[model samples]
Target: MQTIRLTDLIAAIEGTAGPMGDASRSRRPGADPDSAAEHPTASGAVAKESLTRTGDRAAKEGRAPSGQGESLPVPRIVTDSRQVQPGDVFWALRGERLDGHAFVGDAVQRGARVCVVDADRVTECKGPAAEAVLIQVDDTLTALQRLAGWYRCRLATSVIAVTGSVGKTTTREMIQAVLSAGRRVIRSPRNYNNQIGVPLSLLAIEPHHELAVLELAASHSGEIAALAELVRPHVGVVTGVAPDGDSSNPSISGDGRYVAFESSDRK
Candidate 1:
């Protein structure tokens, strides 16, 4: 996993960073000067101590920190409070069945270094363990997507987006298997092809990954376009289209290499 500084993450999600309790008072050695200038709030003694403490806590919990740095390293981005680990960033997402806001306190208690929550529900996240920072955003889901898109643009990896009604997942897996022989490839986990899953998969990309094969799925109009905008794949592949499947054409960008299979049963 790539090391994501707290300041860059705040900027990427267009979120407001809040004070991080008492740990933000001391300084950690070898802090990045350029990163401090980018976001003053995360600079000097405050950021240094906060990050050091986070790393220390992770070590005590038997989890090794990803890197030794002045800047805080977010080891992982988790949506489930149960999976929260020291130095992880917990993104609160609202779903139809369960609201993540309800778990904000639980996440903080579990050693999450940061909590990204909707601005409107910020109050619900108050009174946490105080060791974590709060990032208030307009919408958690949209912010997640935006951050993933921003991160993708910074990577050197070539992305291949696979979308179609019936064979999207299989196509993505096949591509990953073939590419893995020669390159460091990352693929969508399981059938993760929807809005939430797509962004999560993209965020899981590591700095060493040479290629990414993502499966894109849509249950409604405009979803494919939205996912495509975030992916901006170097190559787009459509397996086959069916009348009952998503007919929305994927809008590919950034190189525009595309391949589509013509369906003989097209109505």
Candidate 2:
């Protein structure tokens, strides 16, 4: 018996293409090559793996992707105005004492399409970005979590969940690093290891991703468990453990780290 290498198997399974190096073939013996990719980013987003079904690609499905209405502009969710993008849903989270509700108007003026405000004093900062959807949640963080939960329910990729006082980012990066080095892997970027961070990270997961690595972090008790429930990792990896008293789970390098994950029952 003989065993074919997995790489060969994968190539056979998905098919492959070679570079079309013949300039004459492309130019049709006379066409100009300068017409290629003039305004590269004009309307082109990074080409992710295509997830559109053949039928969906050919014809309109029963329902539109973003509902019956026209596709809405991208919302700039800002924890701070500095990170604001045009047409974003500004998530006005509260700080020590300063509230996001204060800058709601300013964010709208700056090009935010909508505002998701914490419901303590949003009334004071109404108007402007007036066309924005003013959703009222008891806590902004909770609302963010709920939105992410909803998003997870809609995904099909096997989610890789990560959480630790430290090294969560490093581990998550490692997993994504290994997966994406050769494949179109979609994973969270950096230490977005918090409640809000996870959801924001999810937004980065385009339909094109075949895999995703989600980073979760918490300082207080039950933080890991709660985030775990939200992500619903079929496989879990805990990078390390910190002192029980102090709420710091630092990430480190090397395979020599304390990690816990679920496994299938023994045969």
Candidate 3:
């Protein structure tokens, strides 16, 4: 029926610009100043449709321009085949026990507009879904991360990322509730603070959103740092520091304006 087109929402990004993070910037800054290209870990190279436009830049790169010409609204991004819809982009993520590639056909049958798959599985990407855009990348998970990073750089929304050994979710919720009183606030959903969840949370940001409070969770080293590069928050809050467990929560804030960390002494 009715959809919120990027053409309409894109105006919100016109004059707003700031340094988000290196992870969020486009890999290749082309002749067209507005075009953004993504470099997924699947391959060191850019994805065929990663370019926002389909002009000389696309021709020079020998790929079709994707994000530029489509007046049709870009649909929501989803990982599950069951959630696939006519306009949604289905990411076929591979899990240890369950391979998302197996459900590609199901996603196509359900009317997915784009299907992201592993580069090695190009042969399997056939039939009805073939008509939809097939973005072949080195890794679907990394592609998801890159896509979120690319989208984040285009907006001027203020980001506050929360991470710690404990209480990250509670802190994030409290921040969102307080901020929502005056601003249009966006926050991480449930425990969506990991690799997949963090990217999805960033993707949910709209042009109208003034603040984004993302709760980052980590059980190991470097996980928070990796996620921080994606968020590049204006404020980073670490709920607590674990004396026993290794915590990367503080490191996840990057070079932001403010970073709040708890003392090692547990009160």
Best of the two (1, 3) by TM-score = 1
Better of 1 and 3 by lDDT: 1
Best by lDDT: 1
Ranking by TM-score: 1, 3, 2
lDDT string for model 3 (78-121, tens) is 77777677767677776554667888788878876656677777
Decreasing lDDT order of the candidates = 1, 3, 2
- TM-score for candidate 3, please give it: 0.70
Pairs of residues at least 3 apart in sequence or in different chains that clash in candidate 1: none
Report the Cα lDDT for residue 121, model 2: 52
The residue-by-residue lDDT of candidate 1 on 1-267, one tens digit each, is 477777677656542333211111112112222211121110111111112224444422223234343456676888888777877888777755566778888988888877777777776575663456666666666767667766766777788888876677778889999999999999988756666677777788888998889897665444566567667777878786555322343322221123221221111
Task: Decide which is better by TM-score, 2 or 3.
Answer: 3
TM-score of 2: 0.62
Residue 186, candidate 2: how far off, in angstroms?
Answer: 2.5
TM per prediction: 0.71, 0.62, 0.70
> What value does the lDDT take at residue 221 in candidate 2?
39
Off by over 4 Å in 3: 1-45, 48-73, 245-267
